[model samples]
Each structure stands twice: as structure tokens, then as C-alpha cells.
Target: MNIDIVCVGRIKERYLTDAIAEYSKRLSRYCKLDIIEVADEKTPEHASAGVDRQIKAKEGERIAKHLKDGAFVIALAINGKQLSSEELAAKINDLGLRGTSHIQLVIGGSIGLDEAVLKRADYKLSFSKMTFPHQLMRVILLEQIYRAYKINAHEPYHK
Candidate 1:
């Protein structure tokens, strides 16, 4: 499967980048993983909440454009379903069986994702109820994906 992580904002921290890259390399043994970073929308000091939401929506649109046609879209949201590593692997395998060749994972900015993007997602996933920084979330998501692959293969990493 070809999995793409579409996230907002560039990872500025070298450590975070290195960690994400390491997991990406590890994931290559299972499937193709691509991480795409979209520019975060800037909100002015006097911007209203509605304006801020619109900015986020525009950013979401940019991310959505990269999604392949018929790709399974999964959005990361606070109110989404939480799955264990084993369950995630099962889900991935199920998708593969369903003939889904591409999986797009969307990660929003601090303000969260636009409603349109959420509505477009085939699945909505939440890592935790407590919010995390976008950069940290990227690392966590990648690690989980790698763990899921390990669990699917009955590898020792999941133990």
C-alpha cells in the first residue's frame, strides 16, 4: 500500500525530523510511506474565529489536493476513534483486502481540521484526548504505523 501523511506545518526541529524519517525508513519494509507537509495558514491578530477557521479550511484544501483519487482518507481528530496497534494493523490489512491501494492520513494544525476535510475522511482517528503539538503528533503517528506493521508481521517490536 502507498500511505501518505498529509500534515500542516514543516517540522522545524531536527530531532523530530530525524525521528520521523527513521520510522519512515522502517515502514518501507511494509509499505510505501510519504510525508507531505502543507503550509500553515497565518491568522492576523485581529482575526475573528470565523476567519481563523476559513484559513484552516484553505490549508485543508491544499492538503486534500494531494490525495489520490479513490484513496482512503483518514483524518486525525480529537473526537475520533482510538485503536490499539494490533487493531490498526488489522484495519490496514482489511483495507488492503478491500483493494485500497492508497491511504491518506491528514493531520491538522493547532486550531484543528476544517469540517469539510473531516467529512471527506473514510476514517477519523484520535491518538489521545489530550492535545499534542503538531510536530510531536507526526512522530507519534509514524511510530504507531511502524508498530502496527510489526504487529501485523508478528514481529518482536510489538511485544
Candidate 2:
């Protein structure tokens, strides 16, 4: 299986980048892992709803460019379904069994994902209802994916 994390903006923080690098190395044993960063749109401090929508749309366009038609897409959203680590492992396993070779997990910019990008997703996943910084989300997502692989292999992992 090939796993791709397609997210908006770059990780400028050293600690977050270190965490991401650590998980990426661990994931290398299970599958080929790729982290693709798209340019994020700058949002005004006091933007209206329409302005926010436009920002998301601009970021979505950049994200959409990286999404391959053959790849299974799972976009992260606040209202998305929340699943356990085991369930996520099962989902990945099942997708591979069904011949899905590529999986793209999307993390949106500061605002969120656009309607068009959400519509294109095969699945929408949520880590929590509370909003998280998109930069930190990259690390969290990588760790969960690595845990999923460990679970699928029936290997012991920290609960």
C-alpha cells in the first residue's frame, strides 16, 4: 500500500517536523509514505464567511491537484466519522484487499476543506470534535496511520 498525506501549508516548527519525521520513518516498514504540502492561502484576521469560503476554495484547488483519481481519498473534517485505531487498520486492510493501491489523507488549511474537495472524498475522518492546528494535525495523523499498520499486523502497540 502507498500512503500519502496531502496537506495545506508547510510545517515550520521544528518539534512538529521532528515528530512527523519519526512517524514517517516507522511507517516506511509497512508501506511507502509520502508527505505532500500545498501552499495555503493567507486569511484576514476579521474575514467574513464569504472570504473564508474563498480561502478554503483556493487551498482546495492546490490540494485537488495532488489527488489522483485511482487513489482512495479520506479528508479530515470536524463533522466526519470518528473511528478507533483498530477500525482504521481494518479499513486500510480492506482497501488493500479490494485492490486500492493508493490512499490519500487530506488535512485542510486554517479554515477547512472546500465543498468540492469534500465531495471527491471516499471517506471523511475526524480525530476529535475540537479544532486542532493544521500543522500539529500532520503529526497526529501520521502516528495514527503507523498505529493502524501495527494493529493490522497483530503487533503490540501502546494503547
Candidate 3:
């Protein structure tokens, strides 16, 4: 299986970059992994709702470019369904069993994803009701995916 994490903006912190690298290495045995970064727009202080929408839309456009045809998309959203690690593992296994060759998981910018991107998603996943920094979320998402793979393979890493 091929897994792609399409996100907004570059990761500047060294520790987070290192964590991503570690998870990517662990995931190499499970599937091909790609982390794609898109440009993020600067939000003005006290911006209006319309301005926020515009920023998300611009970021959404960049995200849409990397989405592959026939790839199942799972967008991260606060309002999305919450699943346990085992459930996520089952979901991944089922997708693979059903012949899904590629999966794209999207993490939005600080302002969040646009309606269009959410609508295009085959699934929406939520880690928690609380918000997280987009950069940190990337690392967390990678770890969860690695756990899912380990669980699916009956590996000892997922304890």
C-alpha cells in the first residue's frame, strides 16, 4: 500500500522533523510513505470570517493538487469520527483487503480545512475534540499510522 500525508506548510522545528523521520523509517517496512507540504497563507490579526475562508480555500487548492486519482482520502477534522488504535488498524487492513492501493491523509493549516476538501474526503478522522498545532499533528498522525500497521501485522511494537 501507498500512504501519503498531504499537509499545509513546512515543519521548521528540528525535533518534530526528527520524529517524522523516525516514524517514516519504521513505516518503510509496511508501505511506501510520502509527506507533501504546501504553502500556507499568513493570517492577519482580527481577520474576518471571509478572510479565513479565503486562506483555507487557497491552502485547499494546493492540497487538491497532490491528491491522486483512486486514492482513498482521510481528512483530519475535529468533528470527524473518533476511532481507537485497533479500529484504525482494522480500517487500514480492510481498505487494503478491498484493493485500495493508495491512501491520502490530509492535515489542514492552522485555520483548518475548507468545505470542499472535507467534502472530497472518503473519511474524516478525529484524534480529539481539542485542537493541536498542525506541525505537531503531523508527527502524531505518523505515529498512529505506524501503530496501526504494527497492530495489523500482529507485531510487538503496538502494545
Q: Best candidate per TM-score, number?
A: 3
| TM-score of every model versus the real structure | 0.95, 0.98, 0.99
lDDT leader? 3
Q: State the C-alpha lDDT per candidate.
A: 0.91, 0.95, 0.97
Candidate 2 lDDT by residue in tens digits, 1-159:
999999999999999999999999999999999999999998999999999999999999999999999999999999999999888999999999999999999999999999999999999999999999999999999999999999989888957
Better of 2 and 3 by lDDT: 3
Per residue, candidate 1 scores C-alpha lDDT tens digits across 1-159 of 999999999998999989998999999999998899899987688888899889988998988788777899999999999998888989998999999989999999878898889999999999999999988999999999899888878889886
Query: Candidate 1 regions off by >4 Å?
Result: 44-47
Clashes of 2: 0
User: What clash pairs does model 2 have?
Assistant: none
Question: Quick one: ranking by TM-score, best first?
Answer: 3, 2, 1
Superposition TM-score, candidate 1 onto the true structure = 0.95
Candidates ranked by lDDT:
3, 2, 1
Model 2 alpha-carbon drift over 4 Å, by segment: none
Question: Which residue pairs come into collision in candidate 1?
Answer: none
Looking at candidate 3, the ten consecutive residues that score lowest on lDDT are: 150-159
| Preferred candidate (TM-score higher): 1 or 2 | 2
